[model samples]
Target chain A: MATVVAVIASTHHPFYYRASTATGEDRPPFADEWVRKILTFRETLTRADPDVLVMVGSDHFHQLWLDNMPQFLIGKAPFYDANWYNEEREFGLPRMLLRGQEDLSGHLLREGLDAGFDLAFSNELRIDHSITCPIITLRPEADLPIVPIYTNIFAPPLPQPKRFVQLGRTIRELVESWPSDLRVAIVGTGHLSLELGGPRQFGPHGPDPEFDRRAVEWIANGDLDGCLAEVTLDSLHAPGNATHGFMDFMLMMGVAGAGARADHVDTLDLFHTMEAYFTWYPNGAPTA
Target chain B: MSRYLLNKFLYTVDRDAELVERYRDDPRGTVAWWEAERANAVLNCHTGEASTWLRFTDAEREALANHDHVALFSLGAHPFLTLTLFIAMFERDHAEPLGFQKQYAVRLAHFDLPYPDIAT
Candidate 1:
C-alpha cells in the first residue's frame, strides 16, 4: 500500500535560484528579504522526505511547441538527471536529488493508465529550471527519487479546471495502488499572485505581495475550492502574473482527497515574486 | 475537434514510405510539411471522440516530412501523443478508409536542467 505523506506546491519562478546569493551575486532586482522566503521553503521540504515524489509541473518550449503537441504526459525515464546546473557558471544543484528510479516511475504510469488517465509515455527527458528550482529548494541534498507528471495548462486547448481536478483524484488511487512500501509526497510548483513581467518590476508595488497575501490566507483557512473558483488566466494575468503552474498544486490537492479542503502551509512575498506554499493531509485509512 | 482513426496516419506512412523517407532527410522541408498537415487536421476536426486518425493529403504529406522532434514536442497535445505510429493491416480492411489500425509509442522531452547528459 502507499500513503501520501505530504503534498506541496510553490512558485517555479526562474529568479528563485538565479537571484539567490548561494547560486551567485547576480541577484534579481528585488529587496533582500526574498532570500529568507526561499530559504524557509528549502528547510520545510528537506524535513519531509517522502519515498516517491509525484511532481506535477508544466513544460515550456524546452520540449514541444505549436507544430506538434502532447496534452497530458507521464515520464518514466530510468535515469532522469536534473539538468539545471551550468558548470561554466559554477552552479551547484540542491541536496536531496536521487538519480534513477525507473521501477517506481513505470508502475505509476501503468497504474495511471489503468485508472483511465491516458498518460503519454517517454524514454529520454531533461528537467527544466522551473521544475528544478523547487527540487533544489526542498531537498538541498537532492536525494528524493521523483516521478514527474506534466499538465498542459500552459499549452493551448488545455484541460479545463474541472477535468484537471478529476485527473488529480485519479492520481490518489494510483499512488495508493503502488505495491511498494514507499512514502509518497506530491509537490505542485507555481505561483499564487504574481504575474510574469508586470509594470511593477522593481520595488514592492507588484502582484507578488497582494497575490501572496491572498493565497496564504486561503491556504491557512483550508479553502481550496474557494481559491480555485476565483483564480483564472485573466484573474492572474495569463502567463504574465500567474504562470498556470499553480494548476499543478491544485490538482495535487484533489489527488490527496483534500479537494477544496487543503490546509495552507506558508506564503512568502519576495520582490517581484509571490512564493506560496500549500500542503494537504488526506483523511481516510492512511496507506502507510 | 474532428476525430479520425490513427490508421489514417499509418496508411500514409505505408503507402508513401518513399516520399516520407526523402522528407526525413530534408529537415527544413519536413517541418514545414508537418505544420501544414497538423493545422488542417486540427482546424478541420469536428468529431467529439477522444482520439482520431489523421491522413495527410498530398500537400500535407510533404509537410509531415519536414517535422522535427523539437517541433513535435512544442505542440504539447498530449495523453495521445505517440511518436511511433505502427501500421496494422487486415485482409479486406486494407482497402477501406478505416481499414488500418494504429498504435503510438510515447516520447518525452528532457527537462531543462543543468545536467551534463542534456548538453550538446
Candidate 2:
C-alpha cells in the first residue's frame, strides 16, 4: 500500500513567480523575504520525500469554461502542460510540463466513483498556476509524477464546502489503500479572503484581514467544525467575493484529518492576498 | 442577460493576444464582431457545431463595449474574468504599478454585498 506521507495546503498567488524572480530595481521590497519563506516551506516537502503528489487546485476559466464546467474533475493524462498565454502575459509564469501518475489517477477515478463522487475525468488537461505554484515553491525539481484534482471554486452553483471536505477525506482513504509502495503527498492550494476585481481588490492586504486571521486558526488547528459552521456559500461572500476558494483548504483539512494540527505552518501578508503554506505528516515527522 | 456570454467574451478575448489588443484598441468593434461571429461557437469543438442561442442582452453588450467593469459586476459577470481582461487592456496605460487595478477597485467601490449573484 502507498504511504500517505504528507498533506499540504497553500495559496496560489500568481504573482509569486514574478515577484520571487524579479531582481534589482524591479524587485518588490518584500520579494527577498517571500523567497526565503518559500525556501523554508519547500524544505517541508523535501523532507517528506514523497514519490508522487496528488495536487488539488481550481481552474480559473483557463481550460474549463462556462460552456461545460465540471464541479470536480481529475486529470488522468500521462502528462499535463501547465500555465497559459495570459498567465505569461500577466504574471510572467513560464510554461511547464508535468508527468502524471496514471495508475493512481485510474485508482482514484474508480474508487472515487464507487465512493459516490461522480468525479469527472479529463484525458488531456492543461493545468494552470493553481497546481504549478506549489510545484514552484515546494518541489522546484518538478520531478515527481502528479494526479491533478480540480475543484470548481471559481464557478458559482459550486459544490458545498462540506462536500469538498468529504472529497478530501475520501482521497485520503483511497490513497492509503492504493496498491503501491511509493510514498504520496496530497497538496492543495486555495485563497484566504481574497477579493479580486471587486471594490476591495488590490488592497494593502487581503480584503478581509479579520477573516484571514480566523481562517488561519481554523486550518492550523484543523477546526473544520468551526470553519464549516461559519462558512456557507452565502457567508463566504462577506469575507470577499472570491473566498469560496477556501473550500479547497477545507478539503485539505479533511485530508489532514479533524483535530490534527499541522506540523508545519507559515504565512506571508502580501498585497492583494495572503500567502499561506501548511504541511502535515500523517504518520510522523520525517527524519531529515 | 447571459452573464455566461459576457464571460465568454472576456475569456475568448483574453486568451488570444491579437484579440486582447483588438478589443483594447476597439472595444465596440470587438464586442460587435464577437456577438455575431463567436458568441454561440462552442469552444473546443468544430465551429460548424455552434449553438443558435447565447446572445448578450443590449445592456450586457453596452457594458462590455464601454469596458464598464462596474456595470459588469452589477450584471454578475465573473469578477476575475473582468479584472484580468481589463487589466490586460488598460493596466499598461497607468504609469505606476497596480495603478490601474487600484483605480478599477475605486470605480466599483459603490457596490455593496449580496453582490448581484454570480451563480450563472
Candidate 3:
C-alpha cells in the first residue's frame, strides 16, 4: 500500500514571500522571520523524502474565473508552470517544471466521480500564489513530483467544511489503495483569517484569535468532528472572506485520518492572519 | 444588471493577448466590440454609454474607458482582476507600476472594507 509518511499544513499569503525581501522598515518583524521558518520546515519535509507531494490550495482568480470556475479541480498536466506578476514585476517565485503522476491522477479522478464529487479536471492549468508561495518557500529547488488540487474559495457557493473533510478522507483512501512502496506527503496552504476587499480592509480588522486557537487545537488533537463543527462557513467568514484558508487546514486533517495525532504544532500570530504548522507521522511518532 | 459584462470584458482582455493589443492600440474599437458582444440594452442603460461609446456613467464603464484602477475596484470589480486591469492600463506608461496599486489601496481605504496589503 502507498504510505503517506508525513502531513504539513500552513498559511501562505503572497506577503510572506514578497515582504521577506521588501525594503520598507515599516514591515512587520515576523514577515521575514516567517519566511525563514517556512524554509526551515521545508528542510524537515525534505528529510521525510516522500516520493510525491499532494498540494491542496485555492486559486486567486489566476487560473480559473467566473467564466469557467470549478468547485474542485485537479491538475493532470505533464508540467506545471506559473509567472505571477503584479504590475511591478514577477513575484520572482521559482518556475516549477514539476512532473505530474498520470496514473495516480487518473485514479483520483475516477475515485472522486464514484464517490459523488463532480470534481473537475484540468490538463493545462497554470497555478498562482496559492500553490507557488508554499512550494517556492518550502521547496525552492522544485524537485518533487506534485499533484495539485484546487478548491474554489474565491467564488461563492463554496464547498462546505464537511465537504472538505470528506474530500480529505477520499484522498487518504485513494493514497492508501495505491499498490506501491511510494511515500507521499500532503501539504495544505492558506491562512486562518484574512479579509480582503471589504469594509475591514485596513487598520482595525485582525485575525480571529479565538477561531484560530480552537481550530488549531482541534487539528493538534486529531479532532476531526470538532474541526468540521467549528470551521463552518459562518465561523470562517466572521473573521474575513479570506479565512476560507481554514478549509485547507480541514482538508489536511482528513488526510491524516481520524485520530491521526500531530507530533508537532506551531502557531504564529501574524497580526492580520494566523499561521499554523502541523506535522504528523503516520506509522508512529518517531522516537528522539 | 449583473456585472457579468464587466467581468467578461476584463477576463477577455486578461486571457487574450490579441484583445489586449487591440485595446492598447484602439481603445474605442475594443470598447465597441466589447459593447456589441457582451453588453446588453439594459446594461447600456445602466452604464449610460452612447452608441459611439463616448459617454459612460457607471463606474465600470468609466474605469474601462479611462483605465481608472481605483474606479474599477470601487465599482466592485473582482480584486484579482482589478490588479490585472491596473496592469493592462498603466503597465506601459507608468514608470513605477506600484503607483497604480497604491491608488487602488487608497480607493479601497475610503470604504469601510478590509483591504489586502498587496495593493498598499
Maximum-TM-score candidate: 2
Q: Choose 2 or 3, whichever is better by TM-score.
A: 2
lDDT of 3 by residue, B21-115 (tens): 77777766677777765444332145554333323346656667776555655665665565665456555665653454444555666654333
Per-prediction RMSD in angstroms?
A: 15.0, 0.8, 6.4
Q: Pick the candidate with the highest lDDT.
A: 2
| Model 1 iRMSD vs. native | 20.5
Segments of candidate 2 deviating more than 4 angstroms: none
Chain A only, candidate 1, TM-score: 0.79
Which lDDT value does model 2 have at A239? 85
For model 2 the local lDDT of residue B9 reads: 91
C-alpha DockQ for predicted model 2: 0.93
lDDT agreement with native, every candidate = 0.52, 0.93, 0.69
Collision count for each candidate, in order: 62, 0, 10
RMSD of candidate 1 to the true fold?
A: 15.0
lDDT score, candidate 1: 0.52
> At residue A100, what lDDT does model 2 achieve?
100
C-alpha TM-scores of all predictions: 0.60, 0.99, 0.78
Sliding window of 10 residues with minimal summed lDDT for model 2 chain B: B40-49
